[model samples]
Target chain A: MKKSGSAGEPRPLSLEEIAKTKGSTESETWELRLYVAGQTPRSVTAFANLKKICEEHLAGRYNIEVVDLVKHPQLAAGDQILAIPTLVRKLPQPLRKIVGDLRDTERALVGLQLRPTGTEVRE
Target chain B: MCLPNLGAESRMTKAVKNKSQEKRSLPKSLTGIQGLDEITGGGFPRGRPTLVCGSAGAGKTLLAMEFLVRGAMDYGEPGVFMAFEETAPELTQNARSLGFDLDELVKEKKIAIDFVRIERSEIDETGDYDLEGLFIRLGAAIDVIGAQRVVLDTIENLFAGLQNQGILRAELRRLFRWLKDRGVTAVITAERGEGALTRHGLEEYVSDCVILLDHRVTDQVSTRRLRVVKYRGTAHGTNEYPFLIDEDGFSVLPVTSLGLQHEVSEERISSGIPRLDTMLGGEGFYRGTTILISGTAGTGKTSMSAHFVDAACRRGERCLYFSFEESQGQLIRNMRSIGLNLDQWVKKNLLQFHSSRATFYGLEMHLAIIHKIVQEFQPKIVVLDPIGSLIQAGNKRDAHTMLIRLIDFLKQRQVTAFLTNLTSGGDALEKTDVDISSIVDSWLFVRDIELGGERNRALYVLKSRGTAHSNQLREFLLTPHGVDLLDVYVGPEGVLTGSSRLSQEEREKAADLIRQQEAERKDRELGRKREALEARISALRKEFEVEQAEAQAADGEEKKRERALAESRTAMARSRKADAADTRKVLKKR
Candidate 1:
């Protein structure tokens, strides 16, 4: 895991690194950033659910960066963040956003494009 | 979280302390918009959110932006504009057309702008969340500028950006509470919904004040109106005021705000024509009174107005003439034909002419523009020539209301208004289309009196309040020298005018000449009769003298014979003394 120690600091993977990794497998390195207002229970749960999903889908090809807007409020304007506990997928061709806590793992995987949306596996 | 909670509690305490001092009336933050403060009884509620809801292109965003700009510039209150739709540069460019320099204000740090763009395609829903990030950003903006005013332009975009309705609703309520706790006045704009005040029912949240703007097109004429749906803790004007959005920004026209409280003036002014003045109680229309001159087409309505304007300008007083049917140059040239030089007054800045087509704008816009110009010019006399054209530009009811408001405004300033109306030939000459005759202080009716194969213009004072005006009809003559009012010829055949009057006058002159000749002949005949009587007397005298002579001669002859006899007898009587003495005594007696 690549970590950004400071709160509200966004560390995006270089495009060259992503492009170089794209030839080896059909899937590339997944770059995710979790935005939160403060250290809330919902954000902690969303971060844990994200980690589990990334490990099960592609073990060593994902990067997660946590951003706390309460520390640097001006950063919210860059991502147009209104709701807390928001997760942004930045490395993909098209950027995506997921708002709320990751309490529903299957729905969270579908939202992050880790699993197919139509298929549902019963617990 | 604990520190923010403590700060909110302290702010709440400070607000509570201010409430005591403001117990008598609700403290209001002035919006500085023209005519809006009057209708709102000052402005929006202080430290509270006001909901401004309208449909698309209804000027909601512009109104909110104006509120902020005016607050910062006029009221010395810094504002923060949180825009959900437009960026700062886009907003600045749009406001620049209305004479607002938003960029300068932002540079001066008098205003803070934050654009929140939410794209639904890019946003996804995972689980539970709140809008705390928005709160932090807003708080930071407010703190940076020390803003006293806040504007959330179309805050309903949050409903589209987020998926959780329950959390969004709860968080919106908390946000409003937080804004209030921060002790700043706020304006929130929302889109109008079908059968609801706002699309997201935001009115349920911001209950202090609600203003609705509407743009409607009727008969191909669009008018923008603003109505304060509800204003708590104060009495506000309930009428829907017509507002204008032009290069000068928003201006609301409160029609019925000015009641019948204008001070009346007993001083009368001249009507330009001496005969017309004589018809109007030997003085003229009352100062600061409305005069309506109603007539059919080509009845000298414009000529009469021109005469009035000339008279006012001749008095060295300012005059403003609004001509809806004729251009300024055309009116000037036409008035010149009647011996009235209006261009000189225009050059001298004593007379101003505002000429435009009646259909160029809606009735409300016309009224608003008139108000603006009147305020700027501040003329003593105002003349609206042929108000009939303006009346036809709008519906009858709207035209009447606008006139009432206009008259009230002019009267309040002690400005005399001279309005001309063109009535249709088929309708009664006494009736006007707008039906404003009853409210006018004086009414002049001009009509075409067809007589002896000719049509003549006749004018009479139909009504003059507080003046004993003449009831006689005078023939209106548009002479090259000027307007002339002649005493109509009243004869056994009724009122005579034009060629028939001239003919009647000529016949009377001929009859007078014949009567004078007859009197002279009678005098001559009397003189001849007297001379003949005198001559006859003299001749008679001569004839009597001749007769006397003849008689005397005859008598003399007899006397001679008798004397001879007497002489002979006297000689005989000499012998006889008695006869001689008697003859001598007779001679002595002779």
Candidate 2:
């Protein structure tokens, strides 16, 4: 997993690394970052739901970076996280973000652009 | 509240912001505010941030909201209102009162209201931060609505919520540039500072237009005034103009509109009275000119004004009468006594009256209201019964300036204006409260000429620019038909009027009668002498004729006797025959 240590500090990733994760002559890998204040109930549910969706749909090709803002509060500025428990899709580029507890799975998937609308979720 | 250094970051972002800002070329976005559009010469600079600063309850929020709402509704440019101090529902409810259906606009995606709620107690500054979250939210809202106008109402609330002043300033500057880069015209409302324009001195950052709104109370009358402090790359009115927040929203009145470049006309309109017309060079006042009728108390000033209006209405021209001293009914009734039937004109809708107390508002507000009504009514002539009452509403200087502007405005529209002023407490005709004689193109003074224990109304043209007017004081008369002017009787004792003229006339008549009687007596004596001379001459002629006839008879008798003696002597001598022949001739002639 690739991580930014705190806000305003971006660790640049090599082009080849991004290319490989975004499926250059290989299976597509998803790079996701989840921001949270602490391991609260809502935050836990968001993380669990996100993991379940990824396991059922993108198992063995996904990486999750969990940023606990309580421990590293300065990291909030980097992603412009006004609210807690925000999920960011870093790979398959054109980075997208969604802010909520991720309770509504279908809406979250559609907002995150993981699946097209009116389609079955892959198992 | 220590602030982190954001110099380098701001510089870098500013470069990018300007690069994007250069790509767009839209110049200005119309605010759609009445008179404000004229003042700004269109509106705020487009795709740039404009600063609107004012004190609390000074209509800052209302101005900003109107900009957005009017832009969206009138100009078809969708807008987003980012309210920092008020909630979304509160804003929606507030806007509803202004006839702006914010909820419907939001539902149609024509407008988006984002309540940027920042609780001071909840937010803590841990380290360096940028307002990227706000930018993202704003960008998202704009993208959703495709807004062309944006308003950040009372952005100073961020100064309290955010603890970092340095970063906040940098971010704000960046945000403004960012809005410009996004190509959306933005209005940022800020709280007025003690001395500076904005609390945070946002004017330094906002380089396009800066408007200042002020609400001041003087003599228990609160007036809202607006002034454009700075407008880059454009000319705007710099004077303080009075504004109002009414049901339709905030309307800023650019009182004078700054210049005196109005068009002039040479067409003339009648002065209502034929004699008065004759006094005015037989052409009356210019079409787009201003006239001043100044007089003392009970000098028939109102009557003259009514005559002017009645004549205008008779000519099928619309007229407006703004009465400050009397109500509409009272004025109509008063005019009726002088044979001016104004009710018929009112019924025909060619004449309208707007009566109000001069103390109803401040002078600027009064000017604004007048301007607004004039625009709506579009009358050919406007009459202010006593413009002096307006002087009581404000200072002399302001009233004078207001008068000049009013005259300039009317002249620009080519509407002839007649303003009546009461010359207070003075014998001469120069006791005007506001010296507006210089602005008026024509001035007619009506005065009371008291002579022989009777006051008489006299009218004269004081000055008529661009025309030669009669320099005579005519005896002004108000007959049942209308106002009339009689030639002032100028006998040996100077100008006479009223009872003095009548008495002078009576004295002249008596003198004329005495002169006539003396001339008739002398004519009779001369006729008697002519008769006596004729009688004597006739008697002398008769006596001479009788004497001549007697002399001829006596000569005839002598000749006859001589002829008899000659006849007797003829017996003795033949020589007597010749004498006897002469005697015979004389006797034959007798």
Candidate 3:
């Protein structure tokens, strides 16, 4: 839950807004905020894995925002991030949070409520 | 349904396995709640979840908060309080009133408060949701502070926030297991269900211990009680114990532990009044004994209490007087009239007066307040003037139970306590509700003896354990000097008291004077008769002497005549012989 949002105050850029600013199309854009504390190995691995999953499934519509909580710790409460390596989906109708490194691609995808391209037939 | 995540499942299995290993006997974590440790044998089971279910306003939240606060402050165990119903600030404010400085504790990192703001309208529960967010938050908070204790206050508030019950229940069970796996003692408060211990049957999951708090009202008096429903692998007290939530926090009086195992003292103390002390055997009451002074109104019960307090104070021992009927000033003034100057004792800091209306709180609260005050003041003697006022606040059974517990507590501490109870109506000496005569070691009954058309106070030692007390009744007199008990005079008209004794003494004095006066008059008359008889005898003797003298004179005169006659004969003879011997006669005449 986003507890507070100061209207006139400067805030960190979301991945979708950054993507739109980068001249990406506005149709069905995926926005995600990956919270990390410093440049730890687990955080690095989580970011790499999240990028790989987005590049493979959503090449043109995906965006990822890396928020280093060590530098901006106050932003953790805004996204309700408790764990060190957490990925919050901000653009989706229903916000979803996944804790820990995204080592298991299937579980991370399922936790973030993102379906693979051919998952319909698999189900 | 095939579960996609094995990580959480494996963690749950590991927790369950560890808990089963501890099923033989659970270790304890002392709750630091008064009298609760005695009942639970220690406290709640450690490193496991204890469910606290109670109705609204039943003090469930306060109990949980106290558990956390006491653990952090007293035991050096850091705690995390996860409030699902109240915000952090609100909780801090509420706890501040109870003297739990949550803000300072939070700042010191001894305890962490995380308010879980989950509004129902703001959340959308899609398919396949879990409480992993909550787990992460709790785990992070615990790890940050290295908390050994965790309190989830009012977990039922989640039901209002979350949409799905099945998922919530399953996730909650997993959460409790996780908390146990984390090896932190957890207390989960829940709203009481209609027919179950908790609304969602949460007791089945958090089954190590379950405590139920109830605030019930009877006859317009509300009493808060706590009961331990179950404590797995440990023996616990099953009776319902009354608890109080006040500024000092929660205190539960273990009703079942009030056994007669307290140590007795051979040391004797005076009952304040020397006469009263003589009535109670030769010495007085036992030093640590509970004394019950029962009487009707205006029978000098409070006055008797004041005397005991005064005696304790005079001994340089600290005393506490709990006046439920009179204010402190009024009590000091009233006692001054009876010659007990408690004000000086107060000034010397040897005596304290706690005056409050009896109806100010319930019986349990009153007991808790007394316990707190006694602990703080550490008085050597305690006087609860007219404990009967407590009976007016609640049921008779509750008052009786409270008295028994209070007396037990005092005796356990080796404190001399004097409780005065006003016996209502009649003179049968019937045991009233506030009558603790059975439990006390000494029972002094002050009665108003209505004789001689006036009411006179009388005191008698009805029962004094371990001492041979006097059986005679004494007329209790409350004079300006002090309390003095006069031996009741046994007369032909039964016990003489008041003006009748005075009148009877006066009558006896008058009768004695009359008898003494008549005897003196008779003695005087006898003396006058004896003096007159002696004078008459003396006069008779004088008269006899005079008569004897007259007789003697007559005899002398006769003798003289005889001599003269003899002389004449001799002269005649001499004359006759003179012729012959005129010269010889003249020589003889010469």
**Candidate 1 CAPRI classification by DockQ:** acceptable
C-alpha lDDT score of every prediction, in listed order: 0.83, 0.78, 0.79
User: Tens-digit lDDT track for model 3 on A57-109?
Assistant: 66888779998776665565566554457677766534556656787777676
Q: Between the candidate structures 1 and 3, which one is better when assessed by lDDT?
A: 1
Q: State which candidate, 1 or 3, has the greater DockQ.
A: 1
Candidate 2 residue lDDT tens string, B306-423: 9899999999999999999999999999899988899999999999999998888888778878888888889999999899898778877777877877886787788999999998
Which portions of model 2 show Cα errors greater than 4 Å? A1-123, B1-26, B96-99, B121-130, B219-221, B258-260, B562-590
CAPRI class assigned to model 2: incorrect
Task: For candidate 2, please provide the TM-score of chain A on its own.
Answer: 0.73
Pairs of residues clashing in candidate 2: none
Error of 3 at B393 (Å): 1.2
Rank order (by lDDT, best first): 1, 3, 2
iRMSD (Å), candidate 1? 4.4
Docking class of 3: incorrect
Write the candidate numbers in order of decreasing TM-score. Answer: 1, 3, 2
